[model samples]
Target: MGIELAWTHGVYVLFVLGIILMMVLRRDTSLISIIGIAFLGLTATGSVIASVGGIFGSFIYAITELLPTILVICIIVAMSHVLTDTGVNETMIRPMTHLIRNATLAYWVIGIVMMVISWFFWPSPAVALIGAVMLPVAIRAGLPAIGVAVSMNLFGHGIALSGDYVIQGAPSLTAKAAGIPVNDVIAASIPLVIVMGVVTTVVAFWYLRKDMKNGMIAPASHNPVTSSVFSSAKVPLAPGIKRTLAALVPILFVLDVVAMFVFDLRGGEATALVGGTALLILIAATMLAHKQKGLEQVTTHLIQGFQFGFKVFGPVIPIAAFFYMGDSGFNTVLGEVLPQGSHGIVNDLGVALAHTIPLSKEVAALTLTAVGVITGLDGSGFSGITLAGSLAQLFATALGSGVATLTALGQIAAIWVGGGTLVPWALIPAAAICGVDPFELARRNLYPVVIGLLVTTIFAMFLL
Candidate 1:
């Protein structure tokens, strides 16, 4: 039986589609998202006053949820500014320039590094670490900044995050929900993740190279946070001092990695570790480089970093607010509006979708992918994965096979779509760091991810 639908669900889905339509047209979605939130509030509460307050409340919820990311980005950007100002950034990347001398090498090398690091610490930290260091090198090696963003996003968030082989967080969630062993989900996902990662990245790279050669891509502008905020007065660090700081930076980060492994830190703990380290580095670098003015310079760099962080995230907040309502933000924003027994708006929709589909290996594969995609629209790749696993179990019972394969397929699709690559707000870290429009990154990823999902789903059918 299908879950009962509420008016809130219909309204939510309508606005989601509208937001997507606006995005597809390359239009700003903030207005649409805000309007949607207001309407959802009004429809649920029947009061203009409450509805208006809900809009602001939803933004709070979004910001609260996104604060860690914002903090990390702001700190990392500040640290990066200091590194650049002190000439330490150039010294740091000088050795890497030899390894990534061309655009092709830059793309793959950075992507591979991102994927590996993400497997250990998750994509959020990996993005900060790699973007801070590799972005300049990649841009200098002739890869556009957006291209660098795409490579890191696809490899880290898309590939390593989806598989989550080392941490096993993604698989553990799906496995528990599917009533199967975590190893089964992991084992099943290895092939699907490989196929999706290889196909999507190859296609994206091909398109990127073709566009570059055709002169269709523009050279990237410098990050406004760094360029505009950095004073014309360069910090006169001795070459030896700059080299020492540069060397120290990597050693500090490497120790953080060792700590992650020893302490079993993951996700927010991992991000906090990285952010705290960046803060110390920012302070140290500023003090070392600025001498007499160091105290004041650190504050200036931090303010600049916060400005850029919020500026880049401004358009994203409203949309994220709207989507967050589809999950945990519902009660927080609108208060007991959804029908009783509802599994959140998005999950209910996924459940309804699964019930409506007929059972066959091909249909089951396709339905799981669709459910995964639908649930992923909430932008928390994880929020609806349990539903995906449950749906996978349901379909597998009906088809008498392929539970692990279907579960893996759903997990992969969910993470690829919402974990980052195709979601504008979800991918902000990469986009903001690389100084590209998040929507454009999402658009660029759309075809490749869609094609990959199609191919991987078909492959899942065969595995069944």
Candidate 2:
């Protein structure tokens, strides 16, 4: 792995650290990220005009990449608004409310359900399926919106996605890259995944309980846009109608899950299916609740959803634009600026870090973890796993042992960070669905995830 660092790489690293520092300080990094893009453009192209254009180009690239996620969120939120307005949300969650009597039960039940569904259908669609029905119940049971978001995020995105046992997506990628059988990676990952999942979830719950006791966090509240939409006057559906719609919504989602299995749809396709169903639900609920004004009312709900979606995503876009440069976005936004044979800025950094480290079981395990975390900084968890897999192979070759363990370690770290519970943009689905700030969700996840990674890495060293 010979990577020639360019001036642009240094600039990118500087800005990445700056953004991270800002996040650590709880300050917004939008301006810093925008400026970083400008600097990168200027360094790569050496033209004021092109650099200015690159900033916009980067934004466009970020939006294009994020548009699918944004659209699904908007549609789901719109559907939720109509359900709330028509009183269907209450009826839908009434059954679950009996099961989850308090915050502790709410967190674990939501999390465990999220993990199971995500294992089958993948997290993106599972989030919509579970979050829509569960959030109200969790909140009603005294869990904060942030707590609900964190549970969905850590369980669905971090644990289920990292192992990806049922779908085999994550293990396939890592195993192929490591030149091992997929089963080897999966077998090796089972213990690590359990360790990470158990530790992280437990730590998070402990902190949550402590905070709730001290009154550090509030009970769930609606986001501004949703609050306004909920406040809007609409004709209430009859109790029977609400009960019928409530039953119908879950049946529709369950069918979507079944379709996923029959059709083998995953990721974007699964999300699209859920989003389309949400739109249909939105239209049906609007027509039933506001017969004469249904057309206008549905449009109004959509508008509010869009408003909420964009508001949540606005601060994230610039930061996302900056991180995108770590991968494919660099060349697309600013032309060929990286040195020849470079595997993008982030990948190159991971390779360089791996090369600099000495090879031993402990060093190998730790270095792979570091490489996984570094590569994950791109915020596309899967994007960097190939590099992690390759590095794992390299280290295992030198040590003559522990290839599977190292590969699994790297995969776990990468997904936990980027697939992800740490990255704000990557965790947006849970945050948006629960009506919480993505950054705060990321913050609440940081300590528990970090501690989990630390313990898991040590455990990996033992397995090695």
lDDT of 2 by residue, 1-464 (tens): 56878888899999989988999999998999999999998888889998899899999999999999899999998888888777788778889889999989999999999999899888889998887788778777878888888899999999999999998988999999999999999999999999999999999999989998998886455445234223433556888888999999999999999999999998899999999999999999999888999889989999989998998899899999999988999999888867889989999889888888777899999999998998888888999998889989989998998899999999999989989699889998888887788888999999999999999999999999
Could you tell me which residue pairs clash in candidate 1?
none
Clashes of 1: 0
TM-score of model number 2 = 0.97
All models: lDDT?
0.89, 0.89
Clashes of 2: 0
User: Any idea what lDDT model 1 has?
Assistant: 0.89
- Give the lowest summed-lDDT range of ten residues in model 2: 224-233
Query: What are the root-mean-square deviations of the candidates from the true structure over C-alphas?
Result: 1.8, 1.6
TM-score of each: 0.97, 0.97
Candidate 2 regions with alpha-carbon error over 4 angstroms:
222-234
Candidate 1 regions exceeding 4 Å error are 221-233
- Lowest lDDT sum, 10 consecutive residues, model 1, at 224-233
